[model samples]
Target: MLVLLPPSETKHPGGDGPPLDLGALSTPELTGVRTELVEALVELAGDVPGARAALGVSARQDGEIARNAELRTSATLPVLDRYTGVLYDALDVASLTRAQRARADARLAVGSALFGLVRGGDRIPAYRLSAGSALPGLPTLRAIWRPALEPVLAAEPGLVVDLRSGAYAALAPVAGAVTVQVLSERPDGTRSVVSHFNKATKGRLARLLATTTGEPADVVGLRRLLRRAGLHVEHAGGTALTLVEPAI
Candidate 1:
């Protein structure tokens, strides 16, 4: 039987600092508090089953504490990025101090477990194979790119393109914006590009256009349009969009 503990205050034994006055701190500060709590819980729980059970209870209690702290720190966190719509608070990892980074890493592990639960049984495929290389198969490769585009395209009605120059470009007609960036490369010397749609490229005949655009420009809308147009959109990242017929 699973036993859940009631929320309670358990002071940090080290007394590093009073339960992180998150209300007075920044998002980075709140992240630090969260990291500390995770570390303390992990230490307390150790490797025993009983410790694991206790840690679960501690996590639930601390999550509420962290949320409350975040509310106080919300004013300090940056606003969501205009293009991607991903919350700046969620992406504030780079601003954390080294100690904070360690703590954040532990919290991230917990968060990953939560994501796994919400995804049901679908495991994020291991991109690297046993031979220290990317796994073979076009279908798997396509799957990798789909998720990367889904969230971004859903938030902004545009195409994400990976350019040959090893940069990513996000084009949006609504904001009249085009951003290009270079993504990291794999050990095997493969680079990726991601481009979004804008007025300049919207009417162009392109594979990504065939796969991701329609009259309205949203991903779901474009998907329906692609189906009606009898086009198959594969998941080969930039390669898929590059293959479409050129615009006249």
Candidate 2:
């Protein structure tokens, strides 16, 4: 199975690897658009005030524009290693066993606003861009990405589990991909969709799948695996799984 994850707004700065190489990313088809976006971002960075306005950032986030300026020259890290926050903190890739790490490298890819999609082992630099951002002198990211990215996702073999947030998911729609929703289950049997815990649950699930010996190939198998892992899971029909978290 292939798992699709969203990119984090915050990234761990610097890396031990080589600089960013468009050709080295997972989807070669994305290089053209990546190049375009990179050029626009670099150009926009030349004008700090303009860049801040376009990126929707305040004075405190001015450093992000500088990060964009040095995108190519900066150090690089493995795709998963670069992104950090609630979801990635829960995934905690650094703590995984070697075998689990290998599995994660083979099975996971991240949805990026700048690079399109990158596999776990792909090396990338810290850059500032979001699925919702509209770069100066460029078409909307959705417009630029959909044409090239959608075909690449559709062509992938095996079942896909998409864990991207709303904006990133709009960048490319994966055909036949299963989606997951995390819900808080209360004593009265009512449920509410969780935000922070939703990401954490998905991260934990990603880790479990990465380490498992028997990988699931479809929604049914995924549901079974999640249940076996002690999750209160329910098959929500049509390629959707609800991981019910007990109310706190």
Candidate 3:
């Protein structure tokens, strides 16, 4: 199974791995797009004001632009280790056993505004970009990504669990992938879509899937896998799964 995860705005800086190498990443079809976007980012980074405006960041966040400037040369880490936030914090990859980590390296992939797509084991550098950002001299990111990303993702052989956030998901919609909705159940029995908690739940779910001994063949099998991991999952409909968590 392929688990598509969303990239985090925040990352753990500096890595022991070599610099970013697009050729080495999975989904070679995205190489051209990734190179184009990276070049745009590096060029824009030359103009602090332009970069800040394009990236939707404040003056204090100019450091992010600097990071973008060094995208190609910066030391790198596995994509899973590079990103950090609610979802990644919950995934807690650092704590996984060797076997579980190996499984994670095999099954996980991250959706990126910069790289287009990256596998868990793919080494990447700290860079600043968002799926919503419209870089100068480029069409809408979604437009640039869809044509390139969709076909690559569509070619995946088995069940795909897409946990990308809205904007990243829009970058490339997986035709029949199972999408998850995280809901927090209240004491009164009402459930509401969660934001912060949603990421955490998805992270936990990804960890579980990564560690599972057997790959799930279909949605039913996926439900069984998650259930075995102690998560409350319900089939919402075709290509949809609702994960209910206690009110937080």
Candidate 4:
């Protein structure tokens, strides 16, 4: 299965890996646009205030812009290690076993504003960008990404599980991709959620799927996989599942 996760706004800086190399990334189809976006980012970084406004960052986050400026030369880390937040904290890449880590490298991919898409094992620098941002010389991310990204994702080998946040998902939506919604069960029989629970649950679910020995052939198989893992997964209509948890 191909499971796509969302990139985090916050990231772990610096890395031991070599500098960014577009040709070496897994999805070679994205290299052209990746190069374009990367160059755009580096150029924009020359103007701190303009970049701050364009990237939705603040004065205190100037270091983030500096990261963009040095994107081509900065040391890199695996995409999974580069991103950090509640979701990534739950995935906890450092704690996974060797076998599990290998599995994760194969099954996990991330939706990105800069790279378009990246696999778990892809080495990349820490840079700042968001799905909602509009760079000065480029079109909307959705426009720049849709035509190029859609075909590449549509060609995936098996079931596609998309766990990206709304904006990233809109960047290049997969046709009939299996998706999950995390919900909370309140005492009043109402369903709602805080984003914290939603992201954490998805991260844990990604870890479970990554480590599982059996591959899910379809959405039915995917749901079975979740259910067998002890998650409260229920059908929530076509191409979607709802994972219900107690209200936070």
Instruction: Name the candidate that leads on lDDT.
Output: 4
Rank candidates by lDDT, best first.
4, 3, 2, 1
Model 4 reaches what TM-score against the true structure?
0.98
Q: 167-245, model 2: which lDDT tens digit per residue?
A: 9999999877999889988999999987888889889988887778887789999888888889988785899888898
Q: Write the per-residue lDDT of candidate 3 for residues 144-163, one digit (tens) a residue.
A: 99999999999999999999
Best by TM-score: 4
Q: Which runs of model 3 end up more than 4 angstroms from their true locations?
A: none
For model 3, where is the 10-residue window of minimal lDDT?
Answer: 228-237
Cα lDDT tens digits for candidate 4, 1-248: 89999999999999999999999998898999999999999999999999999999999999999999999999999999999999999998899999999999999999999999899999999999999998997899999999999999999999999999999999999998999999989989899877998999989988988889999988899988888988899995689998998886
What do the candidate models score in CA lDDT, each in turn? 0.26, 0.89, 0.91, 0.93
**Alpha carbon deviation, residue 237, candidate 4 (Å):** 3.7
* Candidate 1 local Cα displacement, residue 155, angstroms: 11
Q: List the residue pairs that clash in candidate 3.
A: none
Deviation (Å) of 61 in candidate 1: 24
Clashing residue pairs in candidate 4 are none
